[model samples]
Target: MTRTARPRHYLMCRPTHFEVSYAINPWMDPSKPVDTDLAVAQWERLHALYGELGHRVDLIDPLPGLPDMVYAANGATVVDGKVLGARFRNAERAAEGPAYLDWFRDQGFTTRDPEHVNEGEGDLLLTAGHVLAGRGFRSVTAGHAEAQEFFGRPVVGLELVDPRFYHLDTALSVLDADRDEIMYYPAAFSPGSRAVLARLFPDALLVDEADAEVFGLNAVSDGLHVILPEAATGLAARLRERGFQPIGMDLSELLKGGGSVKCCTLEIRAAA
Candidate 1:
C-alpha cells in the first residue's frame, strides 16, 4: 500500500483553561486532580508536531469557564468549506457551540447553527463516500440526517455501545480519506454497527482492546502521517505495517477529559 501525504488545515485551541472540574462522560473524574500546566505542555507538542509535518494550523482563544474548549474538534463539523456548528448535549459544554460558531463567522466561513444536538466532529467522522455519524451518547440520531442534508453526502449512522468510547472518533479513525481506509475497535460500536462497518469497509483495521483503552483510535491522519497517542503501541505498529507513518504523542492529561489527538484537532476541509 502506498500512502501519500496531503497538506491539511486544522483548527486548535490551547489548553489554557483545561481542568477536569466536571465529569461529562466515563473518562472524566472531578475528584482526580488535573495538572493544567501539563495538559498545556502536551497540547503544545501536538500543535508543534502538526507544523513540523507541514500542516497549516489556526488557533482559537480558550474561554475561562469553558475548560473542555480545548477539544476543538467538538466545536463544529466542516465539510467542503461549509461549517455546521455543534450543539453540545451536556450543559457543561453547551456554551462551546456558540463560541466556535462565532469564530467561524468572524473568519468569513459559511456557517450554519445546527438544529439537532450535534457534538461536532467528536461524533462525526468523514470518509470518501460517507459522513460516519456516531450517536447513543453525544450527538442525537437526527443530527445524522441534518449532516447529510447539509454536506450533501451519505451519512451512515453508527451506534456507540461503549461509554468509554463516547465519541466516534474515540473508537474509529479514517487513516486515508482518499483511499477510504479506516481502523476501528469493534467493541466500541453496537453489533449492528459492526456489521455495517464490515459491509462498508471489508479491510478496515480492527484494533485490540489494549489499544482502544489507551485512546489509540482517537487519532488524526493527514492521508499518510497519523498522529496518535504514544500509549497505543499496538495500533501504531499496525499503522506502520499498512504503509502509514504513525507519530505517537502524549496527551495523557487531556485523556482525563475524554479526548486525545482527534479531539483536540479539527480539520478545515475545502471542496475537493
Candidate 2:
C-alpha cells in the first residue's frame, strides 16, 4: 500500500521537573542523577520536529515534584472525544492520574474515572479498530475490561512478561493502523499474548533484543513516517527497507527516566 503523511495532534509536557526522585520502575534509579537540562533540550527538539511536520502540538503544565509527568502518554487514553482516565498503581504517580482527567474534562471531553488500575496509553494502544491493552506489570486485567466497555471497542489484553518492557508501548508500536501493521518484541510478551499478536498481526515486524533495549518499539508512526530513538540502528534500517521514512532523535537523557519519543507523546484522536 502506498503511504502518505497525515497531520496528527499530540499532547506533551515539558520535562521542567523531570528527574528520578524515586524508583517506581526497574530503569529508574534515584541514586544516579539525571540531567534535567539535557532532557528539556531533547524534548524541545522533538516538539519542534512535530511542528515542523505540520502536526498540532499541545502542552500541559508540569507541576513541581512530579518528575514523571513529562511522560504525558501515561496521562489518559483519549478516543472519540471521550477519555478513560488512568488509574496509576503506584502512589508516586497516582496524583498524575487525576491531573490528566481534570485536563480532559476541562477540554470538553467526556471523561470516565477509572475504577481499576490502568496506565492510560502506556497500557492501552489503539489500532485497527481495536485496543491492545497491557497487563501484569502496572495495569490490571480488570482495567482492560473497563476500557473495552467504555470505549465500545474490542480490547485485546496482552500480558507483559519482561519487567524491562513493563508497558505495552515499550514493547509494541502501531505503524499503520489502517493496514494493521505493527512492530513488537516477542520476548516482552507472554506466550499467549505472542500468539494473539501473531493471529492479529501476522506480518508484524519482529524487533530484535538490541533494538528493543533501546526502546525502538516505543516509537510514533504516521503510516509513512516513523520517529524513533537514534540508537535503534537495526530498527531504523528495517523501517527504511519497509519504505518508511525513519527519523531518529536522541532522547538519551529521557531514557534515564525510562521513557523515549513515544513515551513523551500522547496522540489526540477525535471520536469515530
Q: What TM-scores do the predictions have?
A: 0.99, 0.98
* Shift of residue 195 alpha carbon in model 2, Å: 0.8
Off by over 4 Å in 1: none
Steric overlap count per candidate: 0, 1
Residues 1-272, model 1: lDDT tens digits: 77889999999999999999888898999999999999999999999999999999999999999999999999999999999999988889999999999999999999989999999999899998899999998899899889999999999999999999999999999998877889999999999999999999999999999999999999999988999999999899988999999999999999999999999999999866
